[model samples]
Target: MPSRFTDEREITGVADLTPVQRDQLRAAGKLYDGEDLDAAARLVDDPDDERSFLGFCNLWRVVDGSEDRYDAWLYQVDSGTIFRAGTTDVAAEIIQFGLETRDPAVRAELGPALVEAGLLPKSDVSYPEFAGLLRTQQGA
Candidate 1:
């Protein structure tokens, strides 16, 4: 069975967005308001709202042509704990980004999954270093 994250329809750009989806993306952007991921997550009052928020965050690159901003959004989502409850595609994307950016937080959150996915080896030394950083942050 296809996962909920698996959208068969391809949305190429802003022009391809539906009116409601566009509105949701705009609302989500407002909630994001200058790099605040917690604020965006707070706007999600329910599952439907969460889905809309994540969808916008995930596809913002297509609309704005900003991969770095999208990576920031993914990092924020993971930091906000939304990524823990996100779909497979969300996890996979974040893991991929983590590997690319060497983001300790993302590595800490998805280390095991990364190994399982073969993106990182089980013996990866960086996992311990990143996990230690995560522990320090949690303890702080």
Candidate 2:
């Protein structure tokens, strides 16, 4: 089972997108909106229920070519959180935690965009470091 964080997948960022890419992404999987995730999260009756988790993305990247590619939402397999009597805030927290938790591996793969979005540390470290490291530097 290949995950969205799959290392071998080819990626084309937003700038290079085309109509064909849109078609390919659609074919890959339905791009669940934030609202959709929110609704689904609310329906999470059991902590182990996986179907309640849906894929959501504001960012777009075309992976591989329509010729052959994997599901854009393979992240769903690695992501999602369950309700805790619905927890502190069912709608907001589920989506927040789920997205945050699943993103590290993928966010590191994001370079300028993650930096621009302020989700990553703006520093001299490369993308992998931005995603993987804890920055602690001192001036002596």
Steric overlap count per candidate: 0, 1
lDDT of 1 by residue, 15-124 (tens): 55555444444444443343333333433546555333433334322111221212123323332111222121122233323443345544444443333333344355
Task: Report the C-alpha lDDT of model 2 over 1-140, residue by residue, as the tens digit.
Answer: 11111222323233343444333334233333333333324234555755343233222221322322222222243322211111221111112222332445443333322333343344334544543422211111
RMSD after Cα superposition, model 2? 14.5
Candidate that would win on TM-score: 1
lDDT of 2 at 122: 41
Off by more than 4 A, model 1: 1-3, 8-12, 34-140
Among the numbered candidates, top lDDT falls to 1
Clashing pairs in 2: 84-87
Give the TM-scores of the predictions, in the order they appear.
0.25, 0.21
